[model samples]
Target chain A: MNPCNHHSVSIKEMQKLCVSLVPIFNHLQPTEMEKIVHATRSASYQRGEQIYGAGDTSAQLFIVHRGLVKIFRLSESGREQLIRLLEPGDFMGELALFSGSPFDHFAVAMEQTELCVMTREDLNAFIEQHPKISLRIMEEFSRRLERAEKLISCLTSEATEQRIAAYLVELADEHAANSFTLPMSKKDIASYLGTTPETVSRKLAEFQENGWIEQSGQRNITLLDRYALQNL
Target chain B: MNPCNHHSVSIKEMQKLCVSLVPIFNHLQPTEMEKIVHATRSASYQRGEQIYGAGDTSAQLFIVHRGLVKIFRLSESGREQLIRLLEPGDFMGELALFSGSPFDHFAVAMEQTELCVMTREDLNAFIEQHPKISLRIMEEFSRRLERAEKLISCLTSEATEQRIAAYLVELADEHAANSFTLPMSKKDIASYLGTTPETVSRKLAEFQENGWIEQSGQRNITLLDRYALQNL
Candidate 1:
């Protein structure tokens, strides 16, 4: 599939659609929405392309328009700590936009990805005019904080297999099916779970051997015994 | 010190002061501020008393008017992972206030603590009338997310000693003095750093042996060689 294929939709219309889809901008006044639509620019990155990096001062508000983006930070010990994964309709770059600080982490395109971009100045002006947008932004931040805190607990306390099990259950629920494709590679999953890629592979193999799950391909996973995995 | 001794100041006056001092309510119009002031309530918790618990549905915005509060989560493994220590003027409970969801963690008073709180409904009303407050809330969320991400990196990748050193340096900077009392107990610090209390004690002893720090008592710490700690 050609990632760039947008059919008959014009780029301008697509940009407006992307902005409208973002939770922060939803239900805005027609004119208020127009201000955002006018300011947003559509951009795309190829798989493996770096979108932003640590210490980048000019961070703009980016709404993931399509595909996947990886957010990670390089630790002092020279290991990458996966911070978050942004899927379509998710937004990032708020830290810099809100605090006027440089990026503390990095963002890369995990696959062919499109983003609806807005300069900090433009977004700030829009936010200033719309309290609803500000409220939405707070809600997004609150949700992310809750998830981050959970991840902290998982990283500090849960064993490798338990964490992996928890992750699979979460994914199965997200996909609403027993069989689903992994959203990320094993290496990325390991970084996110605070384990090594080898450990993730070993744990998955063990799970398969115990009839807890089945792996058809590198990314396709089937939860054969989700109850067992959940209870693990 | 008598935690309840507020001289002759009335509770209403104190509540108004607390709300005004919060960054989110700062710079509000007189009438707008009056709405929040009318809705704000003052409450206190004794040392070791829980302010809220995980799964609590009636979460209200809590501003630490005085004393320390500990925010932590009990993981599936039954280990306590300290998420943050809230000092005076810090606020929490946004998870419920913004999204109307239950809290995923618990908060307890480390000392006799005073709080300025507003119910989610009342706070929502005030926020609807004040765009400035919403923007400030978004900014606060952004700041906390950045810190949370940093903590995730520290917990997952940093050595216990390095994390401890970073915490000490942070406290020194916060206090603006090389000699200051520890804000929280060693056990709490250990939990925050994902280590055991014994390890924390051993590491502090090692730091003193290396002339990097001096602990006069259980809580008083003098950063004799802060530069060394920074370079650790």
Candidate 2:
């Protein structure tokens, strides 16, 4: 996949695409979005391609234009923990722009993915010219911090079963339905939930036994009793 | 204690004070710092004062001008976890600024403290007017996020003993000395380390017994064997 072809689209069409997909960009004027769109360069990565590794220079901020990405770190024991999953419109590397530090986590393309990349210098310049955009970026960073805090709390306090249940609830809420397909494999989900695949499998079986959820296929999960699952 | 001494200080004085304290402000021209300092209002809090509670609307950004403050959250069982401690020149209330939501943690004065506060509206206006300042603010937020992530990783992976050792090492590093007084009490340390007071007491005693550290008093600790502690 090549992102250069995607960037060949008309600036107006790009602005429309950005506004339609990115919530923060939605409030921006078309002219402002056009400037941003023009400044951003698009790139594509194959599945398992390393978008950036831990300790890479924090030069640019990346927005997933399409496909999935996993941001994670490896423990001393070499176990991978997926800290976050990025879908289309989700932004990564903003933290690096602010800190001036190298990337702390490895970001890998979970699938062939398109990314809109903007250098920190250009983005900072744009933000300097448009303070409102800075405010939006700040808001986005704040939300991400809150979510990260919640994840930390869950990882520290919740049991494996509860973690799995919470993950399901979160997926359901984000997807806006009781039934949804898993974006990542079981192993990925297990790592994300801070447990093993066996534990995740057992928990899902328990949920099914309790009539809280129904597993139709490897990737498909249907919440039969959301309230019951919530209690868990 | 009330902060309304109403002793008006010149912007020049404010700039000088800020320059000596915050490294981020050190790079700014006197004129820039003067504008920022003039915008900030000074306030004081008595020891144990609730500067802000979790869920309180975030109206201002606070920079600790003097003394210590603790940021924390209470678990469902009423167990408090000290997320981080702030010293002079450190900033807080940023999480609220970006989220446009009530604070997620409670901030309390650990000692009689002075703070320089700028309303969120004023800060936003300042950032809009000076994009470079926005970049600095983003840098601060990024540093915070990095620290939070490291803390989370330690909490998830390290044992209680390892966590305590790590905390001591961190304290030593930050204070730039092997010997330092703990700003918070043993109970507070226990909460911060996600352990019990008894556990903290035992661990400290063990460290002392093993000649890794020495206790001069209840709060004063000296690292006697840095290598031993680091290896542990």
Candidate 3:
């Protein structure tokens, strides 16, 4: 797919559509929405491109307009920790936008991606005019915090296999299917689960051997025994 | 210290003072703060009292007027996972306040604690009247998300000793002193650091042995070699 394929849609229409896709804007007035649409810019990124990095001042919030993005941090040993894999309609860099601080992590395109971007100043001005947006932003932040707390618990206490199973279950539930293709590579999954790829591979093979799951290809996984997987 | 010693300060005065301590309320006009102050109520709890629990419907936001609170979750085996140790001026239950959902964790008073509480309905009404508070809330949440992300990295990758060292550095910085009394017990500290109390005890002893820190009695700790602790 051409990274520049976003040219097919008029930038105005694309921005409107992207902004509409965000739940925070769902309650916004048409005029308010239009202001956001006007402020938003669309950008395309090739796979493996760094959209933003740690220490960079976050001037804008980016919504995954199309394709995928990975939010992560580099550890002292230079190992990457995958914070999350964001899909289309998911937004990032709100921390910087809200606090006017530099980003603490890095974001990279996992595939040829298109992003809807709006400057912090523009968004803040809009929020000032429509303070209700702050409420929505708070709600979104609350949801993210709850998720992060849960992730912390899992990372600190859960076993590697249990964490992997929990992640798979989450993916299946999120995709609304018993089978789905992994959005990124197993290496990324390993990083996200705080285990090495070898452990992830061995764990998956063990699950397959135990008839807990079926791996069709490198990325395709079917939850044949989700209940048992949960018990693991 | 008597938990009920808050009696010296009139409830009305305490309420206004509590409202003022919240940074989000700093920008509010006196009349606005008055509304919050009028709606706020004070509650006291003995150490080990459960403030709120997982699955409880969150009906209010709590500000620690005095003493400490532990926000945590429980594993299947009933082991606690400390999410945060909130001190005076820190707050919790905002997730329920913003999202109107059940709490995903539990909160307990770590000591004789006094909390300033405002019901969700009252707080939401105040927010509507002064929506700019939401921006501050968003900024606070943004700060929390950043901390949570760092915690995820530490929980997932950092060794117990390293995590302990990092946490001590954070405490020293937060208290603005090299030596301070621990707000929570060593067991709670172990839970927060994702280790056993035995491990925590052993680590502290090791730190003392290495002349990296000095412990007085059980809780007071003085960082003798903060730089060396950082390198650990």
Every candidate's chain B TM-score: 0.86, 0.87, 0.85
Candidate 3 chain B: worst 10 consecutive residues by lDDT? Answer: B1-10
Residue B50 deviation, candidate 3, in Å? 1.4
Better of 2 and 3 by TM-score: 3
Highest DockQ against the true fold, candidate? 1
Question: Proportion of native contacts found in each model?
Answer: 0.72, 0.29, 0.64
User: DockQ numbers for every candidate?
Assistant: 0.66, 0.41, 0.63
Higher-ranked by DockQ: 1 or 3? 1
| Tens-digit lDDT track of model 2 for B1-232 | 2444333787666665454246544446656766777667787798999889887886678888888999888765466767778988788877676666788788899889888887787787777667776676667666777776776666655677888998999999989999999878999888777677899999999999998999987899999998887767
Can you write out model 3's per-residue Cα lDDT over A1-232, one digit (the tens) per residue?
1223343556567655575356766666655666766667678888989898999886677878788889999887788998987888778988888777888799999898888777877776776777666667677778888999999888766778899999999999989999999877888888888888999999999999999889997999999999998887
Scored against the true structure, residue B44 in model 1 reaches a CA lDDT of: 78
Segments in model 1 whose C-alpha atoms lie over 4 Å from true places: A1-20, B1-20, B227-232
What's the lDDT for residue A94 in model 3? 84
What lDDT does each candidate get? Answer: 0.80, 0.77, 0.80
Write down the worst ten-residue block by lDDT for model 2 chain B: B18-27
The C-alpha stretches of model 3 lying farther than 4 A from their native spots are A1-11, A14-17, B1-17
State the displacement of the C-alpha of residue A133, model 1, in Å, after optimal TM-score superposition. Answer: 2.2
Docking class of 2: acceptable
Q: By summed lDDT, which 10 consecutive residues of candidate 3 chain A come out lowest?
A: A1-10
- The superposed Cα distance between candidate 1 and the true structure at residue A157, in angstroms, equals 2.1
